[model samples]
Target: MSLYGEFSVPTDAFALHYTLEQIQEITIETERVVATEVGLTNYFWVSGCNLDEFETVSEKDPSIQNLRRLDEFDRATLFRAEWTEQVDAIIFAYLEIGATILEATGSHDEWHFCMRFDTHDRLDQFQDHCDDQGISFRLTKLHEITQPHTGSQFGLTEKQSEALVTAWKMDYFTTANVTLADVASELGITPQSLSERLQRGYQSLIANTIVVTPPSD
Candidate 1:
């Protein structure tokens, strides 16, 4: 059976150490990743800082290359860049073990990741590889994927589901009794992370249930 795992590593252990240092209040979330012949190309959503400052500091981050601004949003900016593979052992280990990243969020101090592995053995192998590469991380959560298709069925990831359900149970929607911070505290994640999950969950729910395509003429 497949397993899902969540973990966190220090910023220095992963990419963007320099950028994180330069911008103390910034948060980054992985948008997408593609493996190339030479290295990995990554798209990220960055927020809570000035874009010009981010670009200026990114130039000094040895782990990043060819950083380009792809899009601008009200709260976040999209960036595309090439990551130096050799210094990113966690990503290299994920590729080696064929793990799929569900979500990744980073702050100045650490980067949190949720990933799926094909089996217990693969999860173990991934940890072993990271250990061998001198990468250290704190495992936060792990569980077997009892129903692999649940996410597709509900259009929500496990974390998103948990957040929505918990908030609903706490009367967050009806009475507005519980704040986003309260729900985030209950889920043991930052408010920003919970907000992102909730937003994505809402989008998924709307897309899957309400939005219907017109028939071809």
Candidate 2:
């Protein structure tokens, strides 16, 4: 039976910690971490930072294989980067243990990983690898593949889910109620960050639940 495991690794222990310090919000999609001869190249989108600064910091990092901007939006910037072996080994350990990565996201704070494997033994192998390497991480979730992916049904991160729920309960989503700033204050995040989180969460919800069908021919 396939199983899913989720883990959190501190930014201090993650490879892209420096990049996170430069950018504000990074939303990772399913498509990530393609390994290459040089290293593992990954793609993601970020918001609330000067592109030039991101480029500069990434350029100086030896672990970064290559960094390039793919797209620009009013609020977010899309980017791709190849990472060196130093980082790739940590993530690919699951692969070595016969597991597949379903989702991976890194931020200034930490990295969140969701992976699937055929058996508990594989997961145990992964855990053993982490312990042998003395890698610091927290296994936040684990379940049989029978259960849906966390946030997969809703297209929201744990933090985003909490923020949205709090906003709704506080009447921030209702008319003549709290302002974005007020909600942000309650969440202890800046208004801009809160706005981005809400926007992304709503977009995910729409994409996942509101599928439109074409008229029958």
Candidate 3:
């Protein structure tokens, strides 16, 4: 059976360490990643800082290369960059073990990652590889993916599902009577965390359901 794992790692132990140090208030969330021959190409969103300053500081981040602005939103800017393969052993380990990164978000202090593995053995191998590389992380959650036609079917993590369901039950989408804070309180998590889960969950659902492409002829 497939397994899902959630982990947290300090920013200094992962990518964009220098950028985060320079811009303490900024937050980052990865949009996509593709493995290249020599490195990983990434698309991510950044907010809470000057985009130009973020670009300036990114030049000094040894983990990043070829950083470019891709799009601008009301609150966040999208960027594309190449991450040097040698700098992020944790990500490389995931590549080696065929683990899928479902979502990754980072702040000045740390990064939270949700990943899926084909089996328990693959998860174990990923942990062993991280240990061998001296890469440290806190495993916050882990569980087997037992149902494909339900929660995992839409690519939503357990936490995301909980947040979405709870918010729905509270009529968060139907009425203004319930606020994000109210839903967060019900879930026993901070509003910011709840917001992240809801956003990621929405994205997962849209990607898995609404954005499908028909098979090529």
In terms of lDDT, which candidate is strongest? 3
Q: What's the lDDT for candidate 3?
A: 0.80
For each candidate in turn, the TM-score is 0.71, 0.61, 0.71
The TM-score between candidate 3 and the true structure equals 0.71
lDDT of 1 at 41: 77
lDDT of 2 by residue, 1-217 (tens): 7787899877646566766755656433333345555445666666556778777777766656667787665677667777664464356563466566556777777878877777998778777877776777699888886744556445455556767888998998786768999889999999887887676677557645785442342
Collision pairs in model 2: none
All-Cα superposition RMSD per candidate: 5.6, 6.8, 4.4
Ranking by lDDT: 3, 1, 2
Q: Please write out the lDDT profile of model 3 over residues 1-217, one tens digit for every residue.
A: 8887899887887789889888999999877666767768777889999988998899989888989897665677778898874345556555677777767888999989888889988888887877877778689999987877546557666678789989988999999999999999999988877886777678768867898962342
Indicate the TM-score of model 1: 0.71
**Model 2, clash count?**
0
Runs in model 1 lying further than 4 Å from the true structure = 85-87, 150-217
Cα lDDT of candidate 2 equals 0.67
Give Cα distance to truth, residue 67, candidate 1, Å: 1.0
Worst lDDT 10-window in candidate 1: 148-157
In candidate 1, list every pair of residues with a backbone clash: none
